[model samples]
Target: MQTASFVGFIRTLFYILAFYYIFKFLAKLFLPFLLKKVVQKAETKFQQQQQYRPDNSWNKTTTEQEVFYKPPTSQNRSSTKKVGDYVDYEEID
Candidate 1:
């Protein structure tokens, strides 16, 4: 009867060891797939949230009127404003 109890105890220990090793191997094999699934779920949630905002700007407008701009001649350019010419609001006051 003592031998039978010892054998049963050993069997239980063996099963525990076997299950632990199996779980360890399973974690190694399936960890990457589990992580990828989590990332895909997060990405899907992000894409769903993006539907809240519109693609086009609300204030966008187009004009039908034709417009023209005259190119500056050499004489007009000499009489016109230069880059260094700056006006100060403080100096005017």
Candidate 2:
């Protein structure tokens, strides 16, 4: 049977920490370039799509029209109606 050693554990931990820092450093250096290229590609694609689309000249109207909305009014009544009865409750300690 084999037992776990302190030196092996420490070496593994050191390797993990080193890899983390190296990856972080590399990401910082390369992430911006990757993001910028992606953005430029998306922008070019958007421009090309816009160019292929038809103009919205038909949507524009020469005359402007006003719109009016009237809400429904309720009738006045003297009597009041109850929907439900109120229940009284006591809390026990």
- Highest lDDT: give the candidate number: 2
Highest TM-score against the true fold, candidate: 2
Q: Global lDDT for candidate 1?
A: 0.83
Q: RMSDs, each prediction?
A: 17.0, 4.6
What is candidate 2's CA lDDT for residue 75?
78
Candidate 2 structure quality by residue, lDDT tens digits, 1-93: 989999999999999999999999999999999999999999999989877778755565668778798887887876688878899998999
The parts of candidate 1 lying over 4 Å away from their true place are 1-4, 53-93
Clashing pairs in 2: none
- Tens digits of per-residue lDDT for model 1 on 1-93? 345588898999999999999999999999999999999999999878775657645555856987898897666346465668577666554
| lDDT score of residue 19 within candidate 1 | 100
